[model samples]
Target: MGNKNTIIWIIVVVIIIILGVVVVGNRKAQAPANVQNQTQEESTAEEESLPNNEVLPIGNNQSEGSANTDTQVSSTAIVTYTDEGFSPSTLEIKLGDSVMFVNESSGGMWVASGPHPTHTLLPSFDQKKTVQTGGTYTYTFTQAGEWPFHNHVKSSEFGKVIVK
Candidate 1:
């Protein structure tokens, strides 16, 4: 009887240990998923509050275009997309300025370089070129016109870089 009781006690202890191991393993598996969710939420928040155009300082210890000998310095502008659609959908700049379209969306997007229904600006622009997440496309405008562009993948997302 003593031997039987000892065996039963050992079995119960083993069962408890197995249950503990299963619980710990399940928690370990869930930890990564929880961390991923938190990271995604933080990213979304940051995207919402991001500025429309991030102006980089031109040179060392000098304001933008201050040290340049030529007064006709090129300007850089960044266009970003958000939940409310393209931030600053209408961007005005000089004729010789350049604009950079940065795709921060999780999916693909494109910058159709021209007016809708008659896209004459970028005739060679591939309509199906997919700009995946965290991609950038630069376009220089040397002419004065209203160049309308939109995300071909998502038509509702539209913007224009007006070169004057």
Candidate 2:
């Protein structure tokens, strides 16, 4: 009788551990989907609020208007992303001009100013969130320099923006 009771307790403990693992695995899988959904919803809200040609400042350092004191957007440029990485690998734009990073790849892209990981070089250039495929992110160059950028997810791929 004692042996049978001990075996039952052990089985119950094993079952509990298995349940915990399964529950954790399920949550882990759902987390990314939940975040993605939330991001999409927020993006929709932002788009609805702003006009087609308008863009709000991106990061903490960026202000309400263009980087320059003029408070006007000079122009807009495009940088496309595919499996091969950013095309027009090196772009040259004037100050107060914006570069729109368009993701045309199979997966998401997190475009950020490099030295990678830290993204300290041009902090305002960081996208903060992943730009899903077919999505776009634009950053106006407030400062002029050779700004190197990369996909935070795929650090191996990179490009540079020459702001004049």
Candidate 3:
């Protein structure tokens, strides 16, 4: 009878050990997923904190024909979009200058380089995303030419930028 009791205790101890190992293994497997979720949450928080019209510059800083040859300067040009259409339907800017497209209309605006449907003209100039009302997307003119762009949401609304 004593041996039977001892055997029972040993089985119980073995079961407890197995459960501990299983719990630890499961936690280990889920650790990476938890970390990934935390990173995504942090990224979303950062993007949300930024203002809708935040000016984010993208491209090289060097500009041609500056007063200070050693120093580089870039300028920003604003083109506001309204219900009627782009306020400045035509704009002229120099290379390395950035143009900020602000959406002032009631709906979202998708700024993309035109000949509609396919934004193959100056593909890099496309915003590739929808700019909500009051939001803005800035693109630096790198190449010199007459680049036409339009609101993908309302293709009828169009504009042009002549870069020198």
- TM-score winner between candidates 1 and 3: 3
lDDT of 1 by residue, 19-106 (tens): 9999888898789778888888887766654432232232332553474523367787888865456767999988667788788887
Candidate closer to the true structure by lDDT (higher is better), 1 or 3: 3
Quality of model 1 by C-alpha lDDT: 0.73
lDDT of 2 by residue, 111-142 (tens): 99999899999998999899789999999998
**How many residue pairs clash in model 2?**
0
* Candidate 2 lDDT for residue 25: 86
Task: Sort the predicted structures by TM-score, highest score first.
Answer: 3, 2, 1
**Among these predicted structures, which one has the highest TM-score?**
3
Worst 10 residues of 1 by lDDT: 52-61
State candidate 3's TM-score.
0.58
Quote model 2's TM-score: 0.56
Clash list (residue pairs), candidate 1? none
**Distance from true location, Cα of 54 in model 3, Å:** 41
The reply for model 1, stretches above 4 Å from the true place, is 1-71, 115-118, 121-128
Query: How high is the CA lDDT of each candidate model?
Result: 0.73, 0.87, 0.85
